[model samples]
Target: MRMVAVIAAAALLTASACGSGKNDTPPPATVEVFTWWAEGGEKAGLDALVARFDADCPGQRFENGAVAGGAGVNAKQELTRRMARHDPPDTFQAHAGAELLDYIDAGQVEDLTAYYESWGLRDVLPAGLIDDLTVRGKIYSVPANIHRANVVWTNPAVLAGAGITTPPKDLPAFIDNLAKLKAAGVEAPLALGRDWTQLMLLEAVLITDLGPDNFAGLFTGRTDWRGAPVTKAVNDFTTLLGYGNLDRDTLDWPQAERLLIDGKAGYQLMGDWAAADLEAKNFPGYGWFTFPGNGNTFQWLADSFTLSTGASNITGTECWLKTVSSATGQQLFNEAKGSIPARVDVPSSGFSPYQQSAMTDWKSATQVPSCAHGSGCSQAWQSAVNAALRSYSTSPDPATLQAALAQAATQFVRP
Candidate 1:
């Protein structure tokens, strides 16, 4: 009987051990990444990023929650709904500067100050970028890539066809080049998309007209919106629009780029993301340069991911962020995305010639926040500007546009 009792006790202990083992099994890994990168090179870059995450992070299933719209319009709208319902994704894409402040203000994002330190990012990223990303002594997102917004992409073959032997060096040269291209039978001398693309072009014009400091001052209340500098920018933008495609109001940036790629247009002034798209197409003889008269300045925008406050898979989200923050991941993703890695320490050998040039410029160029891309101004301010520009495009009047923009700025520009 004592022997029987000993066997029974051993069986009971085995059962308890089995139960504990089952209870200790790790929960299933899942990560949902949200972004507005739904097509073209942006999607390709995102796929490369997810593939890296899949390879490095075993057993984690990644969910791509991509929404399509220009400048993250649809994605932000959907994200607003999700955040309101308290059902946030593991991570969401956001522009890295004042744009991120909105999420921080709503307490919808987690503080990543500790992660930045632990990951040694503080040493790798530019000090100015770090300061821009930080607010109230804490950072809230991880920037993946830096894009230059003041770039002009030209098809060398088209430029040559248009009797242009050399790219333009300054604003007057650019205008003359457009005239040459038009005389050479080009319908669209300057390819432009809808509202935001016009706004992007306007920002570059503003920089050339106002210089980097005053261009920045527009947001800080240091520069007068109704002053001569802004007035000149508005006039230049109106003149530039005269060279734009007839269907400028109908096409998105991608469609506008198609005009340049097909040799129907001589130049496309857009962010470096367009370069990535061109690279993906393997279109040879394409060249890039900074906006006219703004060679020394970098109108910058960055794509960053923020940790959501209600993330159901914090571990998986952190794993994804760590992977993106790694050098290998940055190189792979940036190669596909047509942008430079945020980490200045990353090797530039993997980048294309255009990207290599951009990286070199990024190191020494005077950095200016891209107002159209959500870095230089608040969302409200940006929206107001966008509205004013849309109306300005329809009217194509400099004086009226200046007045409207100044009124909009007064309403929203806090500083």
Candidate 2:
């Protein structure tokens, strides 16, 4: 009987050990996604992508580490801090071109070339875009969406009230319209925001004064910043700024956009993302046009995702990247994001009319990279330009600003 009791006790002990072993198995990993999409249409787009991730990446939890700031100014600062401390998120949003070169040079991101092949991304994304994303023949990130930076959003009622029936076709006409709107009792005829928004305005004016090739050449050191064309662009930029809000420096893009939305301002020069914001707010009858004189050119930027080198959840990170690059994921995100899918295979049937128009333009327009959005210039270069503009904003010295910009290009432009 004692022997029988010993056997039963041993069996019970074994059963308890087995149960404990089962309980000790680790839970699925959570993906910590870092971005600067904390509000408005950008946030909604992210949320939709997260929902898709939940369905496709089952067993993985999604953690949002979004920071709030227009143009990712705050988020990029925070990300720089985190990366310096070696606390990288699983995946982070990055502009696909020169901005990503900083991380690549630092060896902070992984080479995604093999994954691209496995996922057949090479076949789906545009060949020109693939060339732009590639650095020394290796791609480091996957593009999520393509955004047009030179779009001008207008409040139709404000325009009609100012007796403006058609959009301006050139810089002279644009300035004339601004004057007309101001004379019609609008306090701020052109909506302006922080430094980046101003930088965008400057770039649009450059395209107008310099034409597509010369404007693009400015980044490559082929166009002279000290020349007459750029000077004309700077003068035009200043003229346009005169009609902007007196309190512009304190406002973010969304706040500036609100000026147009509420019918206080006639036009806002911003990215295509404003369309999504307008849709989200249920604002209708909004009008859009390419920045005056940028009619045949598309100033483009792409929001992409990078795989951090030391990500805590490699599986989850890979899952997130795959989902973001997939056609369905791009469709879901772009439909609500006010941008077009990076993948060419994604259909355009469900996108907003503005987006559909942008899609057409994307195919036929002369595409150029946007310095304000980190495609045409490096982060350091962008910062330098922003500093110059900020000082110019307060002091309004065109010569001094032009000199500073030329110095920045000399320092940051690569051979």
Candidate 3:
């Protein structure tokens, strides 16, 4: 009887252990990260964020879904497919402006207003940022950082070779400097890349020089796309592109970057991300300045990530969402990215000389808005603008192009 009782007690204990809530399996966490930042400095920025997620949020894992191209052609295609099938990436990057409303309208995006309130993100971030990220009183995205879009990047040697000791402070002087460089046997005045990236630089110049209000007018259809301001911006951009040695439609962004990196080109109009390439090459004494706006106001741009409707809870995805938003995560990520964190309070001491100056300029601004592509306009609106502008840049047919722009702004996008 004693032996039987002991055996019975052991069986009961074994059963309790097997059925105990503590001993039951704990579910794993995950989130898929979809982005187009697979190469150059973008990868380094991504790695820093990944490291943080792993350290702080155990058991969560990321499926690194990356694709190439400045337009994020592949990434956007994949996202569209997934959203169509009800299987979207946990989170994805989009220009912070009105570019994201399409997803929200499709009901494929989650309203992050609650998350913002719960985490105090609204109070922590700046008012301009809150306005940019929020649509119709609900937040759907969080910007990772602010990438100044109209920076002219060059090596000191290129400037010195042109017999110019200093960059020009105004548009005419800048053009004269480029001409001097070209006359000095410089192969290219600017290292302009092809396709969508090429168009982005042109758009940045038009927006900045046209003034923030007028720039917004172009996107919101308050004003038509012509007149002295628009014409001058386009003409100057075309003249600048004409000086490039490489074909404007074929040069890849990386190859174009090499022109400035190797001191072969006088300069390149690019986003702050260009600094990432400069830093990686250990390229010395690089210079950065806003594209001389021809005595007009400087309008810039921004980009961010928005979680898809069902993406917030995926293990790896959720970890990254938290990791990318936190103060520590943003600083570490943006430092490698050659950008300043979007958060207002992150210390700027670690930034490079140019970056520090840009940060100062950005913080003091009362009305920094988006460029055409990065503007809260849909891709359809941008595409029509892109087509019309591309045609006008090469063909000089302003009448036809201006009419198209007016139509594009007034019509509804099929997308």
Highest lDDT: give the candidate number: 2
Write candidate 3's Cα lDDT for 1-415 as tens digits. Answer: 9999999999999998898866586755666778888877788888887888788788777668787766576777777887889887788887777778778788887777777777678776778778766678888877777777667887778789778887688777888988998899888888877655666666666665676677666766665665677767666666766788646656767788888787779888777777877778888568877777623333455557777877656545555766788889888888887777777778888877776776776666644554444544776666666677666656765466556756776773322
Clashing pairs in 2: none
In model 1, what is the error at residue 152, expressed in angstroms? 0.5
Model 1 residue 182 CA deviation (Å) reads 1.3
lDDT of 2 by residue, 1-415 (tens): 9999999999999998987996777787899999998887788899999999999998799999999887898999999999999999999999988888799989999999999999999998767678777888899998999999998999989999989989897878989999999999997899999898999999999998899989988988999889999988888898999999988888988899999988899999999888888777788688999998886898889999999999999999999999999999999998878899877777789988998888877766788889999888889999999999989878999899999999999899864
Query: Comparing 1 and 3 by TM-score, which wins?
Result: 1
lDDT of 1 by residue, 277-299 (tens): 88677775788888999869998
Quote model 3's TM-score. Answer: 0.88
Error of 1 at 275 (Å): 1.5
The TM-score, computed over Cα atoms with residue i paired to residue i, of candidate 2 is: 0.94
How many Å off is the CA of 413 in candidate 2? 0.6
Worst 10 residues of 3 by lDDT: 294-303
| Candidate 1 vs 2: which has more TM-score | 2
Candidate 2: where is the Cα deviation over 4 Å?
Answer: 1-26
The prediction achieving the highest TM-score against the true structure is 2
Error of 2 at 219 (Å): 1.7
Query: Against the correct fold, how does model 1 do in TM-score?
Result: 0.92
